[model samples]
Target: MAYPIVITPEKNNEHYQYLVFLPDFGAYCQANSIIEALRVAVKFIRDYALINELPPMKLKLPHSTGEQLVTFVNVNLAAKKGK
Candidate 1:
């Protein structure tokens, strides 16, 4: 099953950075930087879903309004490493 995933980056005080992930079923994760953040985020989602016996997520990025929200659809997890 393919599920949508949204990524949003926010900077607090120009020092602290956080990325928010809005996956399917309201599954969300936050971290710093796209690379490190996603690494942990994916693991978190996987573990969380497995714990709940949920299906695999396809990973999608839906468009969102408001500032600090970076949305992308069908983004390859590997591609995030470069950013």
Candidate 2:
């Protein structure tokens, strides 16, 4: 399933470069780059699904500023179940 993620540039934060938000799960993660952010977001969603009932997918995305980007990250929970 593909879930919408909002990526925002973190200002003056030395530890990470971007903040990735998963609206459906009300969870967020940080990474040093956009690619890494997406990777982390996938892991987060997978782990969340493993422990809890999956949240309903949202058709509408959260509002983002001009500097922020909104995109979808695909995760295959069925494939993860075998691990």
Q: Best lDDT goes to which candidate? A: 2
Query: Please, what are the lDDT tens digits per residue for candidate 2 over residues 39-61?
Result: 99999989888788887887677
- On TM-score, the candidate that comes out on top is 2
TM-score of 1: 0.53
Range of the 10 consecutive residues with the lowest summed lDDT in candidate 2: 54-63
Model 1 Cα shift for residue 35 (angstroms):
0.4
lDDT of 2 at 6: 95
Listed in order, each prediction's TM-score against the native is 0.53, 0.90
Give lDDT: candidate 2, residue 24: 90
lDDT of 2 at 35: 93
For model 1, residues 15-83, the per-residue Cα lDDT tens digits are: 436656655656666666766655555565555555585555545556676655554323343443454
Clash pairs for candidate 2: none
